[model samples]
Target: MGKDQDLLHAVKTEDLLTAQRLLQRPRPGKTKLLGTAKRVNVNFQDTDGLSPLHHAALSGNKELISLLLEAQATVDIKDQNGDSSTAL
Candidate 1:
C-alpha cells in the first residue's frame, strides 16, 4: 500500500505511538507529514473540517480526545464547509 495510506491506517487504528514516530520522520520522496490539510494531523475529519476532538465527543473517546487537545490541536479549527470543533 501507499505510504500515506499506511500512515493514515496507523492513526485510525489508535496506534498513536507508531503514528507519532512516523510523523517525526522525514517524509519519503518529499512527502509532507501534516499534509496540506490540517485535519490530516489526527485523522479527525469525516468529510468535514472537524478535529479528532470532535470525533471523541461523538464517540466518547475522552482519553484520546484529551491527548489530542493537549497536543495543541486547534479547538476551533473550521472545516471546508465551515464546521468547527464544538467538541468539549
Candidate 2:
C-alpha cells in the first residue's frame, strides 16, 4: 500500500510511532513539521466515511485522539452514520 494508506492503517491500529513519524515530516519550503506533504490527509475517510479521528475516538483511545488532534485531524468530520469523533 502507499504511504497514505499506511498512515490510515497506522491510525486504525493505534500505531502511534508510525502515525507520528508520518506527521512529523517537514513540509516543502517550511521549517515546521505541521504541514508536511508526506503526511496523509488527516481528514481522509474510509468507505464508511469514518476519519482517523473517528476511529481513535470510537476506540476510546485518549492518547491517540490527542495525537490525531495534534496532527490536525478534523474532529468535526462525520461518518456514514453521521457520527463525528466527538459523538463517537
Task: Show where candidate 1 strays beyond 4 Å.
Answer: 1-46
- Name the 10 consecutive residues with the lowest summed lDDT in model 1: 36-45
Give the per-residue lDDT of model 1 (tens digit) for 1-88.
4444444455456666654554453546876656543323554454554555565555565555566666555677676767665634
Q: Quick one: RMSD of model 1?
A: 6.5
Candidate 1 clashing pairs, residues 3+ apart or interchain: 49-79
Instruction: Compute the lDDT of residue 39 as modeled in candidate 2.
Output: 53
Tens-place lDDT digits, model 2, residues 15-74: 988888877746568765554345578788888998878888877878878888988888
> After superposing candidate 2, which stretches have Cα over 4 Å from the reference?
27-38
CA lDDT, candidate 2, residue 74: 85
